[model samples]
Target: MLVKSIEKRVQELNGNLELSLDDIFYTVCQEYNLNAVVIEEALGCKCPFALIGFITTLKSADPGNYIQYKY
Candidate 1:
């Protein structure tokens, strides 16, 4: 459910950032073999709005690098 919500959000984006928030999420999960649900819930965000703020903050932290729709 968390992954699906994020997918809808990313579909509406321009994808200018090679590494979007969704990418970071999945990568962190895969790289560390963590649980997606547990990690996403920890974020405590509502999709498509506050979530963007979270993403923005992440982008600012590292400049640019996020995406997952390539699959």
Candidate 2:
């Protein structure tokens, strides 16, 4: 859900601005009509990207190496 949502959103953008995870989460949830309880159930820190949702791309380290990836 998050992957497709983020992809669609990125494609729609004019490329002037980037979206933070929170921004994506807020709007995507509204777009999908998801509530807080439902989001918590689906994510709830179950995965690394679970904070906002899931990320579709990883240019550096694997999922286990979040900080390295950030750097």
Candidate 3:
């Protein structure tokens, strides 16, 4: 369940920006506590480029860590 949410969020983030496979994997692991191997296998990317791209996109979209709304 959690993994799915993380994956969805990653996909959403990716959709917003141009992130590499690695960037997505790393961000998922670091921010969402997802397994690297699982994400790699799922995303089919071995390099960190994707994860970097994802992070860059996330950072750009949500700078200063400001919360826009609360659930």
Candidate 4:
């Protein structure tokens, strides 16, 4: 549900340059009825880190947003 809300917000804000990262994050949280902590836990990060990762994911589906692998 949260993911869906995030997706929807992303779609809605995609063409709007006025919406800052904070605006997008807040909007997504509001749409999904989730708190920042929930998102942080889901993303396995803390405040700001989770936000960064979410932003990264929104901009591009980069695997780096999820996890990093070193080999």
Name the best candidate (by TM-score): 4
Output the TM-score of candidate 3: 0.42
TM-score of each candidate structure, all chains considered together? 0.35, 0.37, 0.42, 0.44
Candidate 1, position 17, lDDT: 68
- Between prediction 2 and prediction 4, the one with superior TM-score is 4
Over 1-71, each residue of candidate 3 has an lDDT whose tens digit, in order, gives 44356557777656756776656556656665435665366447754445444435555464233222234
TM-score of 2: 0.37
Per-residue lDDT tens digits for candidate 4, residues 1-71, read 44454565666765588976666666665554446555566666443325544654554454343332334
lDDT of 1 by residue, 5-68 (tens): 4445455452546766566555444543434454367466323344435544654464223332
Query: Whole-model Cα lDDT per candidate?
Result: 0.47, 0.45, 0.53, 0.54
Per-residue error (Å), model 2, residue 48: 11
Model 1 scores worst on lDDT over the 10 consecutive residues at 62-71
Ranking by lDDT: 4, 3, 1, 2
Residue 19 alpha-carbon offset, candidate 4, angstroms: 0.4
Per-residue lDDT over 33-68 for candidate 2, one digit per residue giving the tens place of the 0 to 100 score: 445344545466332245334444432324343222
Query: Lowest summed lDDT over 10 consecutive residues: which window, candidate 3?
Result: 62-71
Residue pairs with backbone overlap in model 4: none
Residue 3 CA displacement from its true place in model 2, Å: 7.2
Q: How do the candidates rank by TM-score, highest first? A: 4, 3, 2, 1
